[model samples]
Target: MPDERTKYAWRKAILAARAQVSVAQHAREAAALAVAAATVAQPGNVVCAYVPMRTEPGDLAMLDALVVGGATVMLPVTGAPGPLSWARYLGPDSLRPARFGLLEPTSQALPPSTVAEASAILVPALGVDRRGVRLGRGAGYYDRSLGAADPDTKLIAVVRDDEFVDELPEEPHDRRMTWALTPGDGLQQLHV
Candidate 1:
């Protein structure tokens, strides 16, 4: 476990660093790269993306491409510090405001059986590293909830381009990222 103070500082640093990337060309290029990476997803790759919040950015415009390409999409729901409950994408009608200022699915959450079905999961993190250490939103909720990720699941972390780095202070329990996503680059398989 990370010391709370270090975790807080890391989160602040990451958010601040991400703010520097406001150029239209940068954003456009990054989105295009991310979307292209997602489009290459093979069938049976369960894509676990998030509803953006706290300034974490992604290419929402590419969702239809992912759907039309025949890949499965699921989003994480905040639960009682338990296993994450996933729901199949049903478009904008399924979302509602969630605690901690995120959009959550308002419709029916899928069965627990669905959680282990994903082969690729896109997790939201403050930062991630070459070794896959993830700095999340200080809750450890993802670590707790995804304790049961399928062995084949690609536990990828989504962050802005600058957040991908060579190292991060880590703890024994920190979840390792299998992949890291950024706008400039689609997805890079991490060493973890």
Candidate 2:
């Protein structure tokens, strides 16, 4: 299990690095992420995806590509805030401001168990090791929500290229991702 200090150190370092990224660079990477996301999704699949916030990599572009590819996409809707509930991604127009500076779909909220329907879940991560250990934003929302997912569900962590690392401190409760999706490298499967 990861010690509290280790988790904090990694989060602080990655956030600092991410803050140095230029707006122009982030936009370019977001576009590339869209291309990679299109390839990861297949027609008629259900995908659970997150809308990037602040310096988080891969914005709605990835979710939009999943829609264009004929996949049913679900985005998180922050409510009382244990495990996140979900809502369908209708389009960019469907999003509205929500708590914690998040943009959520205006559609009806679905139960957290809704993630079990996903064939693939594109999660937001600060970093992920090649071993599939994902470092999130220190909130355990995804960690809680993902526990109900089907074992076959593909968990993909979306991060910047440099965020892919050799190892990360992990916990038994932490769900490991099956893949890491980066802007430059596209989608790379993780081997635990």
Off by over 4 Å in 1: 1-5, 20-30, 111-113
Best by lDDT: 2
Model 2 ranges with Cα > 4 A deviation: 1-5
Per-residue lDDT, model 1, residue 115, is 60
- Poorest 10 consecutive residues of model 2 by lDDT? 1-10
Candidate 2 lDDT over residue span 1-192, tens digit each? 223448788898889888999999999999999999998688899999988999999788888999999999999999775898999999999999999999999999999999999999999998999999999887789999999899999999999999898888898888899999999999999996
Tens digit of per-residue lDDT, candidate 1, span 59-90: 55445455666677787777676567777766
**What is the lDDT, from 0 to 100, of the residue 165 in candidate 2?**
87
Q: What is the lDDT of candidate 2?
A: 0.91
